[model samples]
Target: MAVHGTVAAGFEGVCEEFASFLEREEHDPGAQLVVYRGGERVVDLWSAGVTAESLLAVFSSTKGAMALVAALLVQDGVLDLDRTVASYWPEFAGRGKDGITLREVLAHRAGLVGIDRGFTREELADDRRIAELLADQRPFWQPGQFFGYHGYVIGALVGEVIVRATGRTLQEWYEERIRAPYGLDLWLGLPESEEPRFLSTLPMLTTPEQQAELDAAPYSRFSLGGIAFNEHAPDAVELEEFVNARPVRAKGQASCGGIGSARGLAGMYAAAAFGLDGRAPLLEPNTAAEFARIHSAGTDLVSDSVKQFGLGFNTIAGSFASVAAGSFGHSGAAGSLAFADPRQGFAYAYTRRRYAYPGGAAPENAGLLWSVARALR
Candidate 1:
């Protein structure tokens, strides 16, 4: 295994072992894993073609970043979670959504799960168009009644609210408040100069036989299988277009499209765990406590599996039992994982270019992370 970076103090052996594990798993391409314990980085490692400078698209892991942005605003009294989102962005009041609170929106309980309006890649770049579409859309379920993962809609809702309250787009606010303060390399809206460093996500594999089997399955609530994200045969050309295009990168979809190194992601969580660079708290103690309170603890409507969700981050029970119980973070579509354990004062992040394993359970990269976490304990 080609280890590419040094592990920090007290964790050199852990890093070496993780790199070897990755090699044994045949995890080709690049990946990074960073762990910060008690305000000090103890495990900072990258392997294969990954580097300290390499930044991968961390799909839904961006949700944690978005949640932090909202938490900061809430900390400063610029936004109130209990207040109706319409209280800030009045247009959001349309379609019987006036009762939806910022808390509910962040908690994925606002019922704006799947927008019926089909969005082309181009339409994604226009925030106003997306916001308008979201404002007019009806709830998929009773607001605050259940949790349906709002794949893309939550970003529009939260971003618009942030803009209305702070006079800044979510990306700008994140840069000024979070990224700039910490000198983190994370970018919500990737700049053209950084385009060359970006790694495209491998398309999810699907075959004609698989599609036929999926089509034959009965429509039931508990059924796990369904049409893949790319329903047609895996088209490499379209996959490349989707990942490398500017429209996708510039869209500022907070649920995804975040570009950052694993170190940067780990650093952000470190800042969240401790304070940001010796400044005042990014989130007040009570606010963080409130945010960590689990809101839903059952089968998610979208994933059709049991998931424990806190205010913004998913909880560490059920399938996430391996993670520390109090830990909070988000996982991305293909294998990216980031988490913060306030109890241990530990924060870690792992980002990969190639999709290692499929489905909800953590992949080989995550297993290595768990091993390191256990060793540190």
Candidate 2:
């Protein structure tokens, strides 16, 4: 599991930390780590089975990109966060959901987590289909009262508003404004030309004890967590299968389904927060502050776990010791995490082909991030 790629001068410690983690893994994780300091790529490294250009499914890390697009629209006065969702898309008014504001939806407080009848794989591949199914559905909890993680459909939920208001899909806006402009490798709607670099996500390899823990865990497909992940469906899509499918990759469902390399992910954040290639930053300081500030905190109603969210993005500082207080990003089910730390003047991304045990934001990120912080000092 030899590490590949190079680090900028004086960032040798970050490389060491990456290689050290690879040495300890029982199986090669096929991981990539990329970091940027104010638009400069400081560290770029990958492990066995993946190259710096290799694209992998970034799961919910896709949310970070989704949020950024929303932020840009907001900054440009194209979308108003305080506006009621129904105002933009009248169909959303069905079933007592007329009052949920765009702001509440961004904060995961709109309470439209999922439908009782889960989506088919085809519907899950397309954001519009997912949005249409849940538009008239009742909220699991009173909107704006309790926050739940809209694990699988937050993108579609918000994306529908984008479609209605802007007359363009969120993915389209992302491509025209962000991805294409920056020449980033990350793709919400991956093109056929990029298929060769894409690698299907590998399933998590769990130990017997871990398997036992998973089996023993209290879980039911009917529960909120289960529904959020669409486990209630008769032909539920597995976490890995969601992005691996060609349709999902091509359509780019938004909640997940993003295909990218670590370089692409990290570079996106850099371009968003620090202006890459001599261009201006995508977000103004005020817009970044608004999106990065924690809007929801405490135990998540859906997952029943402590989580904090800042308008569709994870408020990273509270969850990870090394991240700055205003840092905002998202992690994926496959152990990928990407974010921009405005205070630190850095953006970071880590992706793995093999899903890590216990899912959501691989545990290795803590040590690796700390090492990056140390290198900064």
Candidate 3:
């Protein structure tokens, strides 16, 4: 297999396997996989027309980034995870949301699952509009009843809280505190300057008939799952287009629109594992431990299976047991995955330009990642 860049110390084999996997998969147009051990990058490899400089839209992997920012605020006393959401953003009290806590929101237990109504691209850009819809919308389930993945709404809820606490958008706060100081290339809200460098994600492979079945399915929780947004809305072009637009981009919806190289994502997890590179610590050891604590573990109402969740990160068990118990990370919509194992003191990130099958059950990608981690162990 051809290796494109430097591999972390003692992890060259891991990168080799990763490169080979990408080649064999073929469906992956481009990809970057990065691993860090003991606060140092041990496996940083790019292959198949991808490079360290390439930026891919990592779907829900953005949630981990959002969680990191929220954890930082909690550490700095800027926000309290246990506090009621209404305490900070009083308007969140509307629509029986007075009891929702930051912990619940992060854990996907705050019944604000899906917006009861459709939102235009204009509404998505308007923070006030997003918040108003959330405030007025009824919960899909009783609050704290069960976990329903907050697909798009999680970003808005978390972003609104961050704004109330810091008076800065999540993107601004993240760029200034996490991205710039740490020298990371990740962006929560992409800027016009970076737009040219952005790689357009390949469209979903599902046929129109498959998409129709997905849309008509009663259990479909993610609004973006199967419907052709542009055709339905007329104004929306593609899901990515709406997600990456300036207004929505400015809000930094942490659930969907994070753009960065795998190295950038891995580096952030590495910082959490080993502290910032010779600078102030991003998270205390105990803070990281707390962040990794399991908050919910059961059949996720949205994902339709028993999965584990911490405050903002997801825990792996059963079928995902390959990832280890203490390991913390999140998987994006398609196949993007980012994880950090404190036990091994390793952080790993993988991103692809193309969308694979929806559920990451295949052995090619997830198996390859687990294989690399196992090799290091």
Best-fitting candidate, scored by lDDT = 2
Top candidate on TM-score is 2
Q: How many residue pairs clash in each candidate?
A: 0, 0, 2
Give me the runs in candidate 1 sitting further than 4 Å from their true place: 27-29, 204-242, 359-361
lDDT of 1 at 265: 89
TM-score of each: 0.88, 0.99, 0.87
lDDT by residue (77-171, candidate 3, tens digit) is 89998899889889889778899899998888887765644567777555556666788776666778788667666877888898887898766
Clashing pairs in 2: none
The digit string of per-residue lDDT tens for model 1 on 298-367 reads 8777667677777777664334545666677787766778878776667878877765445332466556
Worst 10 residues of 2 by lDDT: 237-246
Error of 1 at 268 (Å): 0.5
Candidate RMSDs in Å, in order, are 3.9, 0.8, 3.5
- Kindly report the root-mean-square deviation of model 2 from the true structure over all alpha carbons: 0.8
| lDDT per residue (tens digit) for residues 80-188 in model 2 | 9999999999999989899999999999998888898988889888899999999869999999998999988999988999999989999999999999998898999
Q: What does candidate 1 score in Cα RMSD to the true structure? A: 3.9
Q: lDDT for each of the candidates?
A: 0.71, 0.92, 0.71
Q: Order of candidates by TM-score, top first?
A: 2, 1, 3
